[model samples]
Target: MADAPQTMVIVGGGLAGAKAAETLRAEGFTGRVILLAEEREHPYERPPLSKGYLAGNSAREKVFVHDPTWYAANDVELHLGVTVDRIDRQAREVHLADDGVLGWSRLLLATGASPRTLDVPGAELGGIHYLRRLPDADRLRATLRTLGRENGTLLVVGAGWIGLEVAAAARAYGAEVTVVEPMATPLAVALGPELGRFFAQLHQDHGVRFHFGASVTSFEGQDGMVLAAHTDDGEEFPAHAVVVGIGAAPNTGLAAAAGLELATGPGEGGGVAVDGSLRTSDPLIHAAGDVASAEHPLFGRRFRVEHWANALNGGPAAARAMLGQEVVYDRVPYFFSDQYELGMEYSGYAAPGDYARVVLRGDAGRREFIAFWQADDGRVLAAMNVNIWDVTAPLQALIRSRRPVDPDRLADPGVPLTEL
Candidate 1:
C-alpha cells in the first residue's frame, strides 16, 4: 500500500486560506502545505479597501495580513496569480488554469466572493466601478485623486457596507455624494428598519443625499462615460461617476460544478452548504468566509454572513474542524462600518421577522444609543449600537452563552451591561 499522502492544498489565498495554513502550522502539522492565490500579491486585508485605503490614509504595505518572510520561513509554498480551474475529488488533485495540477491529501476551499453585477443598461460604460479586490481600490483612489472635490459628483448605487464606506470616502474628499437604494432605508435587511433609518440620518447629516426606495432604471451616457442615471420613478440626475455596491454573490461556481451540495433558498445567496462544524458534504473539503453557508447555533438556522468578523473568526473554526476535531463554528455575528462621523457596530444575529421586541439604551439624539432585538421569549437576539462599544462585549457573551437578560434592565442606559 502507498504511504498516506502528507501534502495539503489550500485554494484561494484570502484571509480564510491564509489563516487555515497558519492554523495548521500552529497545530504542529509540519507537512507540505501549498497556498494558491489568484492575485499576484500576497494575501492582504480587504476591509480597508472601501474605507481607509480608498481615502489614501492607509498604505498598501500596511494592509497585508503577514509579511512575505513569514510565509517563506513557515514553509508555505505560495502560488501567486495561479487560478485553480478544476478540482478532481476522486483523484485528490486541483487543476490550475496555468496547466498545472497539485495533488493533496486534504483540500480547503476558501475562494471568497465577487461583487454582484448590475444588469441595467450602460453598465459597460466608463467611470463606473465596483470595489472588491485591491486593484479595484487602486482604480477608485486614482479617480478620487484626479477628480478632487469640486468636480466629484459620485453616484453610489446600493446602501450596503461597501457603498456607504465609499460614499464616506468621497464625501471626505469633498465630493458631492448621492446614494440610491430600492429599500425603504439603508441596510434594512441587515440592520432592521429602525436602525437602518438611523444610519440614513447619519449619512444625511454628513451632506450625503440618499434616494431611499429608489431604483435605477438605466444609465444614460455618451462616449463610454456615464452622465446620468434614470430612476424608476421617472427622475434623472447628473452624475460624474457611478459605483455599484448592490452586494455580492458567492463565487461558488467551482464548488457547484464539482457537485458539492449547496444551500438553496432566500438567504443562501449561492453558497456551499456546511454543517455546524463547517464541514461540507465531502468531509475532505471545508469552506469558510463569505462563500460558506454556516449553521449558527444562536440563530438556529444556516446563513451566509459577509463580514470581516465572520472571515476572521470562521476561518480558524473551519481550520480546526478540518484537522479531525469536530468544532462548532459559532461566533456572535459581528460587523462594523465607519462612515462620516459615526461608527456603527452590531452583534448577534437578526433575521427578518425575528425580533419581537426592540429595547433602546442611551440617547439617539446624542448619537450614542444601543438597540437590542429580543425574541418572543424575551431573549436578546441581536443588538446594534452607535458609538457604544461598552455594550457589545457583554451582549456578545450573552448571545454566545444563551443567557437571558431582563429586557427592562437592558433598555436602561444607566444600568450597566454587567447587570444582565
Candidate 2:
C-alpha cells in the first residue's frame, strides 16, 4: 500500500468525530477517512437528549450531524458498532474488537464521555437510567410517558445540567420530580453560589422538590427494580423511576491503555493531555472534545469541556493540527441550557474560588439577567446571560479582553458590554 495515499482513522463517532471528518475534506485531504463509531446510529448531538428529544418535542432524526449519504458522498467510511480495543502506537495501528487491524498515518480520538454511575446496592435495578446517549434518552422518555403526569415519582440523583434539564422535562410531563444534590447549591462550581441558589428557586417555583446537601445511601427496589432512594440523612424518597446525572467520566480507557499522557494532579481535569493544538504526546495522534483535557493559551490552563460548542469547534482544530497546521485550540469555552421558559448562555472559564465578585445587570428573580464574575483585579472571569440574545459576541469579548472594568459599569443596563 506504499503507492496509496495515507489513511486517517478516527475513533468515536460523535459530534467531534463528525466535525473532524468534515474539516479534513473541507481542507482538501484526499486520503481515505474512516470513522469508527461504537453506537449503531450516525454521529449525533446529545444536547437535545434531555430536553426536546426526551420531552417528545423533537424528532429523533434531527439530532444527527449528518445523514447516511453524507459519509459515503464525502468518501468517508463510517463503521458502526465497532470498538478499538487497543492503540498500537509503535505499529501505528489500531486493533479492533473483532480482531481486525487498521493502519493509520494519523488518528483522532473523539471518544467523548460516559455518564458517571451511582455506586449503590440497588443501582442495577430496572427502573434506573442515565442520559448520555440516544438509547438512554429513548428509554427514559418511554418511562416518563408510561408513568404519566399523575402517576409516579421521578427522583433525580444530581442537580447538574443533565439532572436539572431532565427534571424540568419530567416535570413538564406532569411527573412528580425531586432533585437530590450533595452540594448545597446547584451548579455552584460553574455559576457560583448566588446564581446556583437562583436556579434552585427557579426549579422550586415550578414545583420541583429539592434535597440539598443530601447523599443517597442506596436505592431500594423490588424484583430487580428501583422503588425508592434512601438518603444518608435517614430520609427515604419514593420513586417509580430514578435518573442519575451526577457527571461524566471522559472516555480515555483506550488512550490510557496505550500509555498516552493524562492530566493528573492539581487543577488538571482528568482526560487525555494534549497541547494547545490538540496534538497528544505522540506526534501522529490527536484528541478532541470531551476526551481531551487540552491546554488553552488564552485561559492559561487546561480544561476538559463536555459541551456541544467545544465539540463543534474542537474537532476542526484537532483535524487541522493533525494536518501539521499551526493552530491553537483557544476558543472561549461556551455552553447554554434551557429549562422551563428560561434560556441561558455562558462563556469563559471559572474554577472554584477563581473569582472574587459577582455582578448582575438585571433582575435574577425576573429571570432576565446577565451575571458576570470578576477577579479582585476586576478582570472578567466569566459571564452568563439568561433570556438574553445576540449579546454573546460582546460577552465573549469582555471575557477574552481580560480588561479590568468597574463593577458599576458592568452592572449598569445602559452601558453596553462591549463599551466596558
Candidate 3:
C-alpha cells in the first residue's frame, strides 16, 4: 500500500507566505502546498504600498508577488479570505474561522504584524488612516490627493519610517505636512541622535514641520471627522487628515494560544521563537517573516526584523528547512527607505546603545555618505549608505568578518572598504 501524500500548510498571504509556497515547488516538493490568506487579495509586497504605490509612481499590478494564474498552474492551493482561528498542535490540524479544518504534515507561520494604533480620543474618526493593506494605501492615496488640491493640512504622528515616508509623499502631492513625535529626533531609536537629526533636517528642508518631544493627548473632531490634534505640551495643530505610524506588533496570538514558545527578551519584539533553521519548538512547525524571532548565527542573538528584505529571503529559507535541507537563516538584517530625492540602505543591526560612535565617509552634507556604527572595540556593528551605490556587498562583508577596523582608514575615501 502507498503512503498518504504529505501536506504543508502556510498561513498568511504576505511576501513571506507566498514566497514559501513558490519555493516548495521550486525545490521539487511534490507534496500538497496549501496557502491560506485572511486578506481577500492575492499576496503582495508591502514596500511599494508605502513608497511608489502611495506616491502614484507604480501601478497596482506591480505589488502582487505572482500572477493570479501562477498559483493554480503550480498546483499550489491558494485559499483567499480565510483566517486560521486556531492551531491544534497535538492533532496537527488547523481550524479556520469559517469552521473549516486542515490536517498538515508540516506547518509554517508567516502571519506578519499589525500597525499599532493611537489611544487618544477621536482616533476612530473618519479622516484618520493607517497604512498596512492595499485598501489602506488606496484610501490614503486618495486622501493625500484631495488634501493637496484643497491646500489642507496633514498631521502625521510618529517620526519613524512610515510617518516620514508618508510625509514625503504628501509633500510631493503638495499637501502641508506636520509630524508629531515623542522622541527628540526622527528615527532616533534606529539611527541614533546625530543621524536622526540629519533626517529631521532633511524633512525640514522640504518644508515639513516637526514637533519633537511631544505626544498627542487628544484629538479634536467634528461630525465624526478629525479636525485637529492636541499634544501634551498644550498645543493644538489643525489637521484635515491624520496618519498614525507609531510602529507595529507581531501577530503572535495564534502561536501563543497554541502553546508555542515566544521570544520575551527585551527588544526581541515579541515573536514566535524559532531556531537558526526557522524551526519552532515543535519540529513539525516553523515560523518566518515579521512574526519570527529567529536565532541568528552571525550576531549570536535572537531578533525579529520587520522589513521587506527579511520577508523576501526568510520564507525560502524556512521552506528549504521544511524539506529537511540545511538552512542557517542567518542573513544580515537589511532595510531601505526613500524620502524625496534621498535614498538609503542599511545593513546589519545596531541600536543606539549597541554602538559606540558613528563613523562617516563621503560628504554627509551632500547626502552621499556611508556611515558605520562601530562598537567600543572598533567592530562594525552596522553600516548605512545614503545615496551611495554598489557597496552593500563590502559593507555586509565587513559586518560578517567581525574584524575591528581602523576608524581613520574607514573614514578615508581613498581607502577601499575591501582592503580595510
Candidate 4:
C-alpha cells in the first residue's frame, strides 16, 4: 500500500512563513501544505513600511511577497486572518482560534514578532502609532498627507532602525522631528559606541534632534490625542503625534507552551531556541525568521536578527533542513538603512574582542566611508559602509571565507580590496 501524503503546516504569514511555503513548492514537495496568518492581507515586504511606503514612493500592492495567483497555482492552502492559539506537540496538531485543528507531519513556526509598547501614562491615547504592519503605515501616511508635515511636531521614541527610518520619513515630509533615546547615541547596542556616534551625527546633519540619555516618563494627552511627553530628567516636550519604535518581542508563547526550548540568552528574548539545522529541541518542529534564535557561525553566538535579509535567507535554509537535506546556515549577516540622503550598508559580524584592528576607508568627515574590523589573526570580521558600496561586495566575500588581509592595505582607498 502507498504511504499517506506528508502534511506540512506553517504558522504565521510574514516573510518567513511565505518564503518557506514557496521553498517547499520549489523543492517539488507535493505534500499537503497549509499556511496560517493572523493578518487579513497577504504576506508583504516589511522594510518599506518605514521608508518608501511611508513616503508614498511605493504602493501597498507592490509590497506583496507573492501574488494570490502564485499561491493558488502552487496548490498551497492559505488561511488568512486566522490565529493559531495553541500547539499540541504530542498530536502534531495546531489549534486555531477559529475552531479548527490542523494536523501535520512537520510544523514550522514562523510566528514572527510584535512591537514592544512603552509602559507610560497616556500611552493608550490616540495620535500615537507603532509601525509594524501595513495598516500602521497607512494611518501615518494619511496623517502626513492631511497635516502637511510642517504643521505638526513628530516625537519618536528609541533610536533604533525603525525609529530612525520613521524620523527620516517624517523629516522628508517637512515635519519637525525629535528622537528620544536612553542610550548615549543612536544604534549604540548594535554598532558599538564609535559607529553610534557617527549615526547620531548623520541624523543631526539632516535637521533631526536627538535627546540622548533621556527616557520618557509619562505621556500627556488631551482630547484623545497625545500632546506632550515627560522625560525622566523632569523635562517635557510638546508633540502632535508619537511613534514608539523601541524594539520587538518575538511571538513565542505558543512554542513555549508546547514545550519547545526558547531562547534565553543575553540578546535572545521570546524567541525559540534552534540548533544549527534550525530545528527546535523537538526535532518534529522547526523555527525561523525573527522567532528563531539559531546559532551564528561568524559571531559564535545565537541570537535573533531582525532584518529583511535574514528573513529571506534563513527561511529557505530552515525549510531545506526540514526536508532532510541539511544546509549550513553560514551566510554573512547583512542589513541596510536609508535615512535622509544617506544610505548605510553593514556586512559581516562584529563581536567583542573578535577584531584587533579598525581600518577606515574614505572620509568620515564627508560621511562617506567604510570601517573594516579585522581580527589580530588578520581575518576581516566586519565592515560598515556609509554611502560607499563599491568595495563592500568584495570585502563581504573575504569576510565570509575567513580570508586574511593586511590591515594597512584594507585602509588604502586607491587599492583594490581583492589585492588585500
Query: Which scores higher on TM-score, 2 or 3?
Result: 3
| Runs off by more than 4 Å, candidate 3 | none
Ranking by lDDT: 3, 2, 4, 1
Q: What is the C-alpha local distance difference test score of candidate 2? A: 0.92
> Residue 129's C-alpha lDDT in candidate 3?
96
The estimated TM-scores of all candidates read 0.96, 0.98, 0.99, 0.96
- Over the full model, what C-alpha lDDT does candidate 3 score relative to the true structure? 0.95
Inter-residue clash pairs, candidate 2: 149-174
- Please write out the lDDT profile of model 4 over residues 351-370, one tens digit for every residue: 55556867888899988888
What local distance difference test score does each model get?
Answer: 0.85, 0.92, 0.95, 0.86
Candidate that would win on TM-score = 3
TM-score quality measure for candidate 3: 0.99
C-alpha positional error of residue 36 in candidate 3 after TM-score superposition, expressed in Å: 0.4
Error of 1 at 261 (Å): 0.5
Q: In candidate 2, what are the lDDT values of residues 1-420, reduced to their tens digit? A: 466697889999999999999999999999999999999989999998988899889999989998889999999999999989999999999999999999999999999999889998888889999999999988999988877655789999999999899988888888999999999999877787989999999999989999999999899988888889999998999999999998899999999999999988577779999999999988899999999998989888887888999999999999998888999878999999999999999999888888898999998878999999899999998999999899999999988899999999999999977798
Tens-place lDDT digits, model 1, residues 143-177: 87766655679999999888889988998887888
Candidate 2 off by > 4 Å:
1-4
What TM-score quantifies how close candidate 2 is to the native fold? 0.98
User: Can you give the lDDT of residue 349 in candidate 3?
Assistant: 97
